[model samples]
Target: MDKAEKDQQDDSQDKMVLESVSGRRLSYDMKTPFYGDCRDVDDFKKLNRVGEGTYGVVYRVNDTKTGRICALKRIRMEGETDGLPLSSLREIMILKRMRNRNIVNVTDVAVGPQLESIFLVMEYCEQDMGTLMDAVPTPYTPSEVKCLMLQLLEGLNYCHKNYIIHRDLKLSNLLLTREGILKIGKLKFPDAQHQTHGIDLIVLFAADFGLARTLSFPSKPMTPKVVTLWYRAPELLYGDAHYTTAVDMWSVGCIFGELMKHKPLLPGNTEQKEIELIVNLIGSPSDAIWPGYSKLPFAKTLNIPKQEYVRVYMQSKPESFFHHTENAPLLSSFNNLKLEFPRATEHTLSLLSGLLTYNPKARLNVKQALRHPYFIESPRPLDPSLLPTYPEIRNQVSEKEKNRRAHDEERKKRLAHEGNDSIFSADHYKKRRKD
Candidate 1:
């Protein structure tokens, strides 16, 4: 079933008694055939392929029953695997618990009848932010940029609240609906939605929870799940495994800077060079202000002693900030973009600064981060009803509506229960051997 169906069921189940009221009795019949693993899902015809990801291919499918439009993420089997992959299971688990405008929602998941593929049904999104950013030629106004930042912060705030951290927060992960509503499109957010934001009419959304992780109450250091090189945060460069939600906050800061500059602030190819580029743009780490700098795994190898470096990189040449809009105030480098985007005003910047601070301890927690002026004082407020939207979203909702979370869970457990026999497992050697 799809997400909407599951929600309706969940709503009804909320009122139902937890005690068991029904049980299935196994009976042998001469004519009745027992369909178990041999009988897979026999629903929903395959439609056009939409996109591909690290694990599978996405298709724009039509639900035969409701004639609904939905995006189906098909999980490929690695041959003879009876169950689903852990990534697929986790994605289902996370999507089930997550309900927000900025996060992508899963509506349905079904196994192919032949056990050939698994399908993930989600709200059909038109485009991704990265594609839109490249496709849309009109530059963003300061107000528009603020609108986007507020939505992203709000979404991030939600994840932090739930102890979840989206490690892969990049442009490609944001998506957009056809009508321009940022439906947590691509990484997540619409291309052009006139969302009510105080005096403005624009909103942004954060998408892609594939790389997200949850922390415990006290929070513990996590694995170095670094995003792409361009969006990698500073602490990750130092090999800090015991990081907190601050790591995601740093990602937010990086994305905020990009929204303003229309370019990646610190685009590095290697860990060493990445730090070198960051230190060049924001200046290298200093023990004086960043006391624990020298102790970092990478910091101990700094060639420069005393760390007397400029805020901007020593090699970076000062350049005038381009005005994307006419009659707009001049933007000083990215360091001061918060000034240009009111949503990123002083308090917001301060909060973001803490996230990007050389010292992780100085970073803001989820609660503290949301309290930042960017979110608290922003003119635009997050409204959930303004979600799953796009020009086509409403039309697609009727047919696409199913409880994807529950369906995903069933498929996930089925996949897990099957283990190595699961087709979702990756095999780099497949093509080589086939050739």
Candidate 2:
């Protein structure tokens, strides 16, 4: 009786241990093995395709188990016969390691029936800043802009402090919730949404990490063609491979200008045009202001416009003033940032200028930018909870609606052009009348 009972008990305990191991493996793993172990992708039902990017397709999905809403990103495996793409692996690894309120949270990894199809489950955000900006008729107010920018910088600061460089930082990559929280994701909120008191409630998360890279000592060279064309930094456009976190600062500056202007600050269609735009706005770069500027790979090749700064003497000071004037270049040719942002306060323009400084070394880092006076001035940054709300334009606008809007804009332009023409100027109209 003793031998039979002992043998049966041992076998039952072994089965329980195996079952426990299987359950734990399927739940969460610190190592995050991409294959096998994860829950099947079938557990979530796709609500709609939210957006698509270079590395993956995003969908708003409903967790069938908990009835929770989440964003499912299907990693692009299109030519990846060998294994998961290195970019995807990096994104997963970086995201899983970092946890910040302003950063998009990767909750779990779900696997499809086939190994090739994998998805990242993340918290659902209702809107992305890019789409929201386009849909809204008005630009963000100063306080509101401050609220958004503060969260962005906080998240970015976290990334830089942790030695991570977000190679790409742009509006589309910044996500927001219905409650006025700004999230700084590579991707929040409630009846408190109607209140003006909960500044802590609003948040901005930095989303897409596909282009992010961990900074190493004596920073290594990375691909210069990493960030989106509009938000790409000057160093990148100049083909500076051994760049630093300053590239991200330049992007943040561009984003700041976009928020103020309600459009891209330097929306050049070509690389050459982009450089020209930068030169025109901030003035051309030279060794005097930005040391080693001439040494940039493309500096000599690009036909950067040369604007001479001539000092005008007041004649009241006589020869003494003249001597100083002859050698000193005027500040006029340096930058026309004031003309561009005529309504911006002195502190605001100062912050923008600091961030957009030609020399990456001179540019403001996240911490410095956060401490700028623009944030502490009157009508200080609005609390996230008090931030205004807008329609979920990204989710609501369809391809057909977008096309229709484009057609309407085109029609309006055509009508406006015709209205300005002389009554009988058109040959086509004359011919039709003759017929």
Candidate 3:
């Protein structure tokens, strides 16, 4: 009785163990495996997490195979029960087709243990302009600004000529290297939307094509919900889906202004505020100026307050600012822009005025902006090598540090205006700390 009972118990236990092992193996095998060109992500040694955004998580990695430092962006595809994300597929296709010094180069593609993970291997740039701008202790000289602007325009012009439109262009998306070369970042192409090329004081290259849309002929209507609010074109803001390359031109203009001012030209918090800020600066749009301004979707639906140009000018500066007692005809003829951007040269102002015009049709295209008198004027843009060099950006600042810096600047501006502690200063500081 004892020998037969013991043998039967041992057999049952062995069968149960085998069943558990088989179940574990089946669950593991259910995960998708990479069948693409490069199958092993282990080929690269990940150094650190450099960036994270809507599309993917970026890591600074060393490619063991090539002995090179590169950025590896791991596309977030958790929800997909199907295949690779279409956005990632478009980015891969676009980058593979692009070969330019001004564009960030995709070196290779790698997959993790399962097809669940995908990574894009790109040539690494030291840091992006947003990080640099917040950390750099100095401002760019006019000549240096020109060189950077020229490079950006060159990259963008090349992209446009190739029929790609960069729907999103902002300070944060523009990256720069230690040697002062710019490369665009975060290229997350829009669905059915297509994309450029450009950068900052460092030689600029157009990065990110994620939100980029291909420019179609006989121009089809595309979504207006592209480009960051501050850098977005008026046509986009006004809900003009049939917008053209002029949308990009407006962003270039904003970037140009940012370079000159060393801060965002229009940091509107909302769509209404953005349009209001624009109208306040350039005056309201009209058929006389914009030709088809009234036909926009926003025009038909939104209650756009009629803005008076002279009133806005007076709000920012004294009415007498434009009036001159010494009536030298040229001095009296000077417009309101001189008062707004006191540091800008006449030629620079001329270019800004053209680029920042109310009418998209009237805005300066890349070639037109490149040919503007500002670039050809007396203080020509110096060669990139000759641009002033600065130390590398400080170890990346935390969000708290950025907020504190912003609040400190606001406090200083308020103190300058009122010569006392403003009522909301304490509350504002508290809010910033919380943020």
Q: Best candidate per lDDT, number?
A: 2
lDDT of 2 at 243: 89
TM-score of 1: 0.61
Name the 10 consecutive residues with the lowest summed lDDT in model 3: 197-206
Give the alpha carbon lDDT tens digit for every residue of 1-435 in model 3. Answer: 699997886676444323322222122122212212342577789887787777677888888877888888876655555445433443464565566666677766666545456677788877777777777757788887888788778777876777777778787877777676666556752322222222110111112453766665567767799899999998899898887777888888788888877888889999998887777676677776677888888876755667654311111222232233221111111245566679887667666666776676667677777766577777888876675555545336679999999988887567556633665565555576589
Worst 10 residues of 1 by lDDT: 17-26
Worst 10 residues of 2 by lDDT: 188-197
Best by TM-score: 2
Error of 3 at 273 (Å): 0.6
- TM-scores of all predicted structures: 0.61, 0.74, 0.71
Candidate 2 lDDT over residue span 1-435, tens digit each: 699997886676444323323332234332322222345578999989988765578899999988999998876655546444333433453465567788777776676545466677888888889888888879899999899999999888988887777787888888898777777666310111111222221112123553666665666566698677778888898899898889998899999999999999989899998888887788778888778888989999988887542222221322321243332221212257778999887667767877877778767778777876678887799989897787767678678989998986675566556764645334444455479
Query: Per-residue lDDT of 203-260 in model 1, one digit per residue for the tens?
Result: 2222234456556545455556456777777777777766666677667667766766
Predictions in order: lDDT: 0.52, 0.70, 0.65
Off by over 4 Å in 1: 1-42, 76-82, 85-91, 114-116, 179-208, 217-221, 302-355, 365-370, 374-435
